[model samples]
Target: MKYFLPATLSAYLARTYLVAFLQLLGVLLSIVYLFDTVEILRRAAKFENVSLLLVLEMGLLKLPEVGQIILPFAILFSALYTFWFLARRHELVILRAAGLSVWQFLAPIIGVAMMIGVFHMTVINPISAMLISRYQAMEANYLEEKESTVAVGEQGLWLRQRTAEGGVILHASKVQMPEWKLSGVTVFYFSKEGDFLRRLDAGTAVIENASWVFNNAIVNSKGRAPERIARESLPTNLTVNEIEESFSTPEQTPFWVLPSYIRTMEATGFDSRKLRIHFQSLLAQPLLFAAMVILAATVSLRMARFQATALMIGSGVVIGFLVFFASSFLKALGASDQIPVLVAAWFPPVIALFLGMSVILTTEDG
Candidate 1:
């Protein structure tokens, strides 16, 4: 019992160190890939076909979002890899023979996993959220400037309308397709050259199957006399449907608002599968990390004399890959409503836990 901490700590340190290193490498690689892709798109956006500093900034900001998804699998694979090597070198066997149970051997790894979960939830997720928000802003600023129509965010809503005469920033606060009315509206009209022209704020704007009707609107026209008009009757060439199509999707709601965002999205009768799956998956992360440790122990721990360690290591690597892809596929299935979100989110860790336990039992009895 007294020796348990030292042994576990040693193993945890080795395992987590390898995991962190691999994950960092993966993150850097992803950053490079994202940078190149973003650069290509940004160049296309430029008249001279050149990328700007803001484009690079946007890429850098997007890296954390990519890392949030990739780091967990990297940690899992790294553990498997490190453990396989330790087993191949016969360290696991020596440890087991030295009166350490497999559970004891895994204790440190599990601890590391828990730490990772906490770090991800408390630190990495928030950081990724901030980066994603920043990236979205940068992307919108870059895009709406060039395109006549721009899609912002994932919901295929909140579009931008550009014209040779002027540009408009259209905000669709809420859309009621059944009533053909858009509630809570704000529009920013810019000069033909993109200078600020006027801003229109409306409450309960409606599209009456034809023209747009602005209710209780305040129009602030800039330049010249700098006039302000407030009236119940406002006419515009912008239609409700057209304005709704012009703003970026409301799906761009900040990550900090995910709880309320999820609720609001669900209430709106939208398919909440993706968000549900993501939230459930977030809740399952600690278990997933814990399962990874158990899996590493089961695959890498020596149970039989004269066993082919190389073969076992290879098997562990294969199994790790299978688990990773299987989890991802299940996540996709859940998002598409082909499976229950809870099942998709929780099954991977549950399945891994069972398999690892089975392996541990098999080894111990033999």
Candidate 2:
């Protein structure tokens, strides 16, 4: 006969797991923030005008991005510690002796893990995205001492390139990738002294070897009459890969807007595989968290007296590192189109969950 825990017991288990998770998250975030602050200070050291307050502010702004990276590990360690603590107190043993299966007691922890994953995806991700974007902008403005070469927003795609005589700023309402073409294009030419020299409007622009081939171009020089040309070639240093890389970074866009942004990018004929992979990865967070919970249970359920705690903890750490490495590898493959995006983002968690569950089922009468 199998025993089941009451709702009250399940709730208590969930509360315990939640508390442990929060404590671990706080400690991990603090450590990450400290390291980030030190790194920011080191970078700011190169700029005499930069202040410690500003460095600290940058660290604070970057904390959420760091926290997001560390969250899965936090969940893994929290579950491990919670299980170890319960086992040390003989709580798990008592519950098991009462005829309850291991799976029965694991229910609440898994539920909590899923909930945490959902909360992270829905709430924390957007906030982190905004902060990270701000952090990058500030770092560029202050630390890098240079403006970004490319930008994408609601208005259009904007690019800046330096030429021997002057700099050119280009705007394209639409971009067609692979062939590297732009439509509804406009280009502004400025002299080295920051004086505007001329402007050109073109119906279409195609990237050639070292210049843009504008078609149906109308040139408007500062003091000259407008001249119309069938085609004009202008020098540029920007490359197709560079432009795509700039706008396709997943971190720059919020989770809530990724779908729409992906659609827009696709509409502009840009290959959005990377963004698609990232979106799928976000959707798989809950499953990954659940997998971590199962993996933790498998490693930490042994009584402290029956095995060396250090060995178990070390084993868990190694397993966690392996999982992360495999996930990263698969993501790379997915981004490069070696595998389907959905497979890359989801296979690791699914495999981890099933493998952990299988191990538990075989080792324990769950």
- Report the number of the highest-TM-score candidate: 2
Per-residue accuracy of model 2 over 1-366 as CA lDDT, tens digit each = 645679999999999999999999999888988999999999898998889999999999999877887788888988988888888888888987888998999989999999999998888889889898899888878897653378776667888877787788999998876667799999999998989999999999998887899999999998899999999998766667766766647866788999998887776667778888888988999999999999988888863537568876887798789889999899999988999999999999999999999989987888
The residue pairs found clashing in candidate 1 are 157-248, 157-249, 158-247, 158-248, 158-249, 159-246, 159-247, 159-248, 160-246
The lDDT per prediction is: 0.64, 0.86
TM-score of 2: 0.90
Every model's TM-score: 0.68, 0.90
Cα deviation at 151, candidate 2, in Å, is: 2.4
lDDT of 2 at 147: 35
Clashing pairs in 2: none
| Candidate 2 weakest lDDT stretch, 10 residues | 145-154
